[model samples]
Target: MSKICGGIFTSHVPGIGKAIAQNLQNDPYWKPFFDGFDPIHRWLAAEKPDVAVVFYNDHGLNFFLDKMPTFAIGAANEYRHEDEGWGIAFARPFQGHADLSWHIIEHVVASEFDPVMCQAMTVDHAVAVPFELCWPGKDAFPTKLIPIAINTVQHPLPSPKRCHDLGKAVGRAIESWGGNEKVVIFGTGGLSHQLEGERAGHINVDYDKFCLRNLAPDPEALLQHDTLDIVELAGSQGVEILNWIAARGALTGSVRELASNYHVPISNTAAATVLLSHSERVLA
Candidate 1:
């Protein structure tokens, strides 16, 4: 059976990708944020997971307001990255694990979660930036990818509890797959920041800290807040933490934080990276 190695939760601010493309990692403005990935680099080197199942939000590259699925999973042979007007150089296309993608799609649907299944998908920075952060200086990402997009771009988004439940369902599906591939789950986007409105440029350090503290050990504690509450506290875009919650929910094992970094004002968002290791499946 396939084994889930662990999960990585991080912010996917577009500027990070620009900084990386420009080779600005050691610059004073970018050092702290860039340094956070050191431990993650080491962990990836050691684990060498064969597949990466990414949970991220699409930023107008794949879906728009007229039509967006609450959940979308890719069953493509490969996923291409395109210019999203961010001016960041396009990263190479990522190879896909179509067999595993179909398996997850089938399993989740059987578990009563309806999702859009894509045979071909275009990934935006939400998917590319995290892969770059985790494995820098690579021509192509080492692991085959399965991109699962959640709707954070429109109203009536999935609630925290619902996202968490989806993650749990995905975890079960991964473990039950009849393959020996080692997999890593990625939950990408947001610590806290709003890009527009009167609350624009808002960064809630206290709230971000609260989330970072509880997310790994007691994700249930976060379910206490509804989606509206999150928007109010973390800012409209900050609600992207829903991705983090889902990623955490997927770790159906005894989990412990191996490394974490939280820094403020990275492109006006609270930039954070967390690397968690899972041991022994905790039967659902």
Candidate 2:
């Protein structure tokens, strides 16, 4: 049977990508942010999972206000990076795990989570930035990808609890696959900092820490807040916590937080990163 080795929770700020592209890791402004992933890089170098189930939100790259799917899964053979209007050059295409992608899509829908299956999709910073952080270069990208796109840009996003339930379903799907591949899931985005309006640079340090503290052993605690509640407390874009909740839900048994880093004002956001692994007693 396949196994979920672990899950990664990260804040995928576009500026992080720019910092790396500009080779500013040693620069004081970006040093801490870049250093935070050193442990993650070492961990990935050790684990070498065969496939990565990446959960991210597109910042209007593929979907718009006209047609947006609450949940979408990419089943393409390869995924290409997009410009996102920043004039960033596209990265090398990421190989896809079609078999695992189909398995997840089939099981997710069977389990009552309606998901739009995309035969093709373009990944933006939300997806690309994390990959760049974990696997520094294209040669270092160890696993095929299964991109899971969630809708958080528009109103009526999935509730925190709902996202968790969906992740649980995805976990079941990965575990049920007969292949012997190892898989890792990633929940990208959040920590706080609203962009727009008068509160453009608001950062809720207390709430962000509260989430980091309770995320592992008691994720259900976060389910109490609706999307609006998160927006009011963590900031407008703080609703991205749903992605983290979903990734946390994907792991069976309790999680062991391997590493965590939090820094302020990473281009108008509270940047954060966490690495989690399943405890010894996981569902088989």
**Top TM-score model:** 1
Clash count, one per candidate: 0, 0
Query: What are the Cα lDDT values of the candidates?
Result: 0.91, 0.88
Clashing pairs in 1: none
lDDT of 1 by residue, 154-233 (tens): 88999999999999999889999999999999999999999999889998998999999997789899899999999999
Candidate 2 wrong stretches, greater than 4 Å:
138-140, 279-284
Candidate 2 has what TM-score? 0.97
Candidate 1 residues lying further than 4 Å off, grouped into runs, are 87-89, 282-284
| Candidate 2 deviation (Cα RMSD) | 1.5
* Model 2 backbone overlap count: 0
Alpha carbon deviation, residue 233, candidate 1 (Å): 0.7
